[model samples]
Target: MIYNTLSGRIEEFKPLEEGVVKLYTCGPTVYDYAHIGNFRSYVAEDLLKRFLKFLGYRVIHVMNITDVDDKTIAGARAEGISLKGFTAKYEKAFFEDIETLRLDKADYYPKATEHVEDMIKIIQGLLEKGYAYEKEGSIYFRISSFPEYGKLSKIKKEELKAGIRIDADEYEKEDVRDFALWKAKKPGEPSWPAPFGEGRPGWHIECSAMSMKYLGPTIDIHARGVDNIFPHHENEIAQSEAYTGKQFVRYWFHVQHLIVNGEKMSKSKGNFYTLRDLLSMGFSPRAIRYLLLTTHYRKVLNFTFDALYQATASLKRITDFLFELETRNFSDGQTEEARNMIEKTKKDFTAALLDDLNISGAIAAIFEMIHWGNKAMEGEKLKKKDAEQIKLLFYDLDRVLAILPEKIIEELPDEIMELIKKREEARKNRDFATADAIRDELFKKGIILEDTKEGTRWKIIKT
Candidate 1:
């Protein structure tokens, strides 16, 4: 079951096309690097796609980069560069950041600036349908014509007085709330020619046009930040349905905002942090991903240093558990016992995900398997096959979590291997000083060693 923001109910998801999903998510504005609060939505959407693929659904994902909205133009003017040039720099950085965070690339990234013709076509269609009006060389969506304007947002048109208009893309108006679909060209700003005016698409119309261009008139799944449920997504519903007389989207999935100190994270409050900011501060990408993915998407995640530290430690424990399973001697147990445990784990994990992506529950199921593995080893009930089962279970789950470090590494340098051999000899020959010195030297070079009953193992610690 999935939570549909439009219905305000949890419903079983059945895609319009059998075994396929057309997913569209709101992308970065491209004015600057996206903050972590923005990524909270991106990462959640990434999780949704990953889980769908895990469940054997082919996903066709499209994310729209809003490169021509009010914020982008303002940023271009400040930078003194062409709008394309300015947005290009940040757009490049945005993809790099997504890769750094280990997010799966969307199948399509339709930039709004490149798709102005599509937006104009949609506006013209709305005009022909009597859903839009031309005003002062600009085109505005006549909210009164679309009687179902407030369905998604619960905003009552009756509460709004008539003869009022709002030209600003995002500014809330107290009286008139007719939003601009095509703004008139202003001095020193980018503009595109349309039948109504030579200007640009409004922020809301950009998503509608781009999403419909790629995903079609009705998207199987549409996701955004919960804060966007107001005028942004609400307007998308109005314009897209006005153009094509079908329901705009099947399911509206929204992720709640990330907060700091009980307040929404934003640049104005000096509380915003980008993915680069956290990476520069020495936090591993996997740890950051784990911390974010472990939370339920609907909950307001409180961003805190303490929580990050705990996330780091939690990931370390999973790695340590993996190491113990691989190195220890566990060759004496019944295969049926381990097989049953593995089946139960897989069942529990997938069941949690099926229930509206209950990721916290899914992860808990994984940890419970880890706990069982550790206990089985202590009781001499774990065999080599059992160990393999546990390892493979984690490998299967990592398709979604992506938290574990790879078990295999390239061969160590000859010098490093020679030193390890010498250190082993020194220990056996009662040369404690020599063994201690060799171990310290290796540690200084970022190699960490752990001795097990079977043998000694060393891993490279990225410095």
Candidate 2:
């Protein structure tokens, strides 16, 4: 089940094609570095894709990169560079940040500039169908022609003033809101020639055209941040459905906003934080990912310094568990007791994910397993087989949560290893001062060491 914003409730998700899901998500505009608040939506969409695949569905996802929008044009003009060159800088940084967070790449990243012809085709169709009109060489979708204009947004048509229009790529009009399908070419801005004359695609029409070009006339799911629900997504439904006379998308998934230090995040508010900003402050990408996924996607996540510290500590516990399992001795046969517990955990985990992707519930189930696994280790009830089962279970859960740092830790320097060996030797020789000194040295270098009854293990502190 998934929350359908259009329907205003949780709905059972059934894909249009069996075993495959056509997912389209709104991507970054690429005018500037995306903040943590922006990433909150992307991370939630990633979780949805993972959960769908976990449930045995193949997902073909497309995310649009808005390279030719008002913001991009203004930013490029401000920098005195071509729009392509200006957006390229931030676009590169956007991908780097996503890679740092370990998000899987979408099947296609359709940029708006590359799809102007497609947008033109849709505008032509709307014009032929009498759902659009040209104003000053710019074509606008005639909302008055479509009676169900405000269904998705629930803003009645009567409330909208007729004859009013918004020329900007993004805006909210109080009257009859006839949004642009194509804007007239202006001096200094990028231009593309079409039947309607030389101009760029509007913001709302870009997603509709690109999504239909790749995913067909209808899509299985359309996911975006809650902010997109109003003029952006609602406008999408109007234009696309008006063009094809078909349901635009079956399910509309929206992730809520992120709140920092008890207020909405914004640069004007001085609470804006980019992913790199958090990383520079000593927060691990994995810990940030973990904190982002802990709350339900629909709920506002309140980010704080204390939450980051808690995420770091929680991830350390998981890594320590993995270290213990990897080094511990295990038997060949599966322990029936451990097998039963693992099976129950697997069942609960599946249930939590299937029921509207209750990630918090799924995480709770994982912590429950970890708690019991640790107890089994302490009581001698955990055999080599039991340890292997628990280890495999962790791997399965990590496939979804992706919070483990083992892959990241493998990149640590060998000097950290030599220090660990020296620390071990100092302790063996009963040289307490030398051992303490070595530990402090490693800690200063961002390496944290933990000694257990099994053995001494080390982790690279991300901060």
**Candidate No. with top lDDT:** 2
Which lDDT values do the candidates have, in the order given?
Answer: 0.86, 0.86
Report the CA-based lDDT of candidate 2 relative to the real structure: 0.86
> What lDDT score is found at residue 348 in candidate 2?
92
- Candidate 1 lDDT (Cα, 0 to 1): 0.86
Task: Provide the lowest-lDDT 10-residue window in model 2.
Answer: 167-176
**Which residues of candidate 2, in runs, are more than 4 Å off?**
162-176, 408-422
Which whole-number lDDT from 0 to 100 does residue 10 have in model 1? 93
TM-score of each: 0.92, 0.94
Query: In TM-score terms, which candidate is top?
Result: 2
lDDT for 182 in candidate 2 is 89
